[model samples]
Target: MVYTMLDKATLLPDLLRRLDKLPQGHALDLRTYKRNRSVLIRRIGADAFDVTEDGFQKERFQVPFSGLKKLLKVLFKREFPRSTKIRLYALGAADGDDLPTGRKVI
Candidate 1:
């Protein structure tokens, strides 16, 4: 059956309540360039939290958006487990050679 706008609207309050119960880090980082393309949540750091959505669902330590769901499943409900990896891409030459684009990593 098709869902009505009213249905989603009714669900919004509960969704917001669930979101609020999450840790500050669990708030989706809409500020990130990569996440601008989709609707997703993001966990910023390693921390455990008790999240209650609506009145029926209660989850702990939920993570946010991931390019790969595998990472989310494995890392679910845990703060920064071990070390967090960071990735960076730079401009290359037209021939895909390592060009001196003058970009450097800190």
Candidate 2:
């Protein structure tokens, strides 16, 4: 799901809700060029996940999936607003296999 600020403003809540149902191992990768950062969220358990960020010293943090809701809210409210450029990519297993690369969502 390549979400822009506009998409986040309008569909963030719904998106998060759906994400909560995703099976373990699902991942969300967020890219921000302006901030020169990339964040990876990988599900480790039903409600547990790990977050990895690129920076001076690549850091990894663990938080419940619920925490992502707050994180997204903060990003939408304070960091990415209006036209701030951002891209989010979602990946998960499909029948024990990775989703096809050529499959288009829309």
Q: For this target, which candidate reaches the highest TM-score against the unseen true structure?
A: 2
Error of 2 at 46 (Å): 0.7
TM values, all candidates: 0.22, 0.58
User: Candidate 2's residue-wise lDDT over 3-98, tens digit each?
Assistant: 443254455666576568867877765555354455566777888877665533356677887687776565445434444555566666422235
Which residue pairs show backbone clashes in model 2?
A: none
Worst 10 residues of 1 by lDDT: 29-38
Per-residue lDDT tens digits for candidate 1, residues 1-106, read 1111213223334434434454443332111122111122323333432221211122333434222244333322232222222111211112212221222223
Q: All candidates: CA RMSD in angstroms?
A: 18.0, 6.3
Displacement of residue 8 (Cα, Å) in model 2 is 4.6
**RMSD in angstroms between candidate 1 and the native structure over all alpha carbons:** 18.0
C-alpha lDDT (0 to 100) for residue 45 of candidate 2: 82
* Candidate 2 off by > 4 Å: 1-15, 33-35, 72-83, 94-106
Each candidate's number of clashing pairs is 5, 0
